[model samples]
Target: MEKVRLGIIGLGAEGGMYAGFLTDGKVNNMVLGAICDIDPLKRTMAVEKYPEIPFYEDYIQMMDSGEVDAIVTCVPHYLHPQMGIEALKRGVHALVEKPAGVYTKQVRELNEFASTKPELTFGIFFNQRTNSLYQTLKKLIEDGEIGAIRRTNWMITTWWRPQGYYDQSEWRATWGGEGGGVLVNQAPHQLDLMQWICGMPAKVYSKVKYGYQRDIAVEDEVTAMFEYENGATGVFVTCTHDVLGTDRFEILGDKGKIVVDGSRKLTIKRLARPESEMSSSMSMQDVMKIFMGHSGNDIYTEEVLEFNDAFGIQHISVMENFAANIIDGTPLIAPGSDGIRGVRLANAIHLSSWLGKEIEVPFDEELFLAELNKRIVAENKYPVNA
Candidate 1:
């Protein structure tokens, strides 16, 4: 009971990474207990690599065997909730991977189920939340360092994937497999961060392109506009085709503005007075003088912060935090309930694009599911190149 015996339920790229690290004892409070995968090759690989650990072709069997105190799902988007529910059903702590699930309905189901099992710790692998850069930004917003948020804009196009990437798996980019492309796969972290740092938008209107640059069936490019409940507006743009992609996130507030580029470098500009106050109080002459840089430097303060690459460390931190939460009474960095926010936002974006109109938060779940089913049916009827 001192250390958590963690079972990993997939041997894909992410699952493999967790297997390597958890087996290597990267997290002091967590040890690799068992590995499970439906793929025979992956099971063989797990056996060859970690012969001491049990290999189960069925996740249910692993959970039923009492070999693992907790389980982390590294499966596809759709299986996350299904497997997580199974883990929680057996009174095992569960840590789900990103995006929660392909849709909110399932994720909400998982959350509702987890709500009943309050004794068990349920968390999601929002590893980016462990990054100091985003942590600082979240605190700044919460602490009102930037007054109230006025606008947010993030353009993250660093997920450049070639055709071979999709060709490797039949379900790589199809609607029936990965759900959506950039938004569902490569951009979930940013989506989670956006809603986490700046509260979820009340409305979202998005223009999405399906397989624009890739040979996939789902969206590969997306541009979404958001309207907050407080009348603040925001924009989110992401795509997977930009080889020289840019990653810039900007949040403007009444008192200051925060900008992050490449997910590491942070820049903050603080104003002596709120923009609302300045707009109402400043005379034309005073504004002109300030605009001319005569007193702008004195009125504004700028700070630049840089963060080292903590990509691997972030994942380790999430795992350790999950274990710590189970071993002690520590709070989770990213609670399993919080995973639905990103999925809901992503659904809004997809629904907005599908309807070619602005969709409100907590939009019609039934309608979205119906529309998604149409695409899923089509994707299955006429499969993609992969």
Candidate 2:
């Protein structure tokens, strides 16, 4: 194939937005040759706009039509794994959106199933991984530029969704609909990035407020604490209620620290001497003198880390890389297997809050599913439309 043909499933807001990447010339060597949506209006609009592209109401038909070698799944939170499994069974490559699925069981099953198809390319739409700013952070952490991490904190409260937004759809901001609130929907990118740069937390304890601001049943505010394998602790806080929101992520380490603010400004602080070295070298009297403020000791230097813009890399970059992986065997920016960690973390948050305890990562999947099923079985609880 000279160029990889693409099929997009679910032409909702997300699918429609990604479709423009190919049509708008943001992604190269990728052609939107097929589209699928149950909504007749979405199909009609897609067809009217691109008559050259084939349209199908059914995903199976789109996969069988051979109109595309790869399919991008941008449906709701729950249908991702189901649709991905279907596409993989047909030997079609898949690029899935965030959250992977509503729960880890489904996502794990999808991962296991996809593992059987080694030849097919499977990537997740973790577009933030393509961001130059995060790329720099990941490199810094991986290279020990900040030494061993002591604590990580990301107070990302900028995902302010209006009440009218939830009213736009019934299956949103509900357990059975969108499957959790800001944590699953608006915060998945941050959740993924959190674990991506630092590493997955070993245990998580959270306090969540449901319908705090919106007239919905799911959590709109979340404050979670994390325990790492290396004994480091972390905090994650987010809400959709604050208007003067902020996005600040910082990783504190023994040797230094990095801080990224709302303006994408990155600040670095490096220690003049290791805390261990300084403490060990100083006498108790001297340490007490400095501690008592009788003497002063400067231990660190602060400076801004500078880097050039990365040419506006974002969703299109992920898409282009997906195509390259299928065509030239290039590595994916986000592997589909890694998508489950975020879902697991989200589940742990929900579970911990529900039980009022700190839950460990890889928490019992069967238990989580059972708890989810209880909610789904409630009268008019789960959104059938979703």
lDDT (0 to 1) per candidate: 0.91, 0.87
lDDT of 1 by residue, 120-169 (tens): 99999999999999999999999998899999999999999988988998
Task: Give me candidate 1's TM-score against the actual structure.
Answer: 0.97
Error of 1 at 127 (Å): 0.3
Candidate 2: regions farther than 4 A off = 282-298, 306-312, 379-386
Q: Which residue pairs overlap in candidate 2's backbone? A: none
Give the TM-scores of the predictions, in the order they appear: 0.97, 0.93
lDDT of 2: 0.87
Span of ten consecutive residues with least summed lDDT in model 2? 377-386
- Highest TM-score, which number? 1
How far residue 292's Cα lies from its native spot in candidate 1, in Å, is 3.6
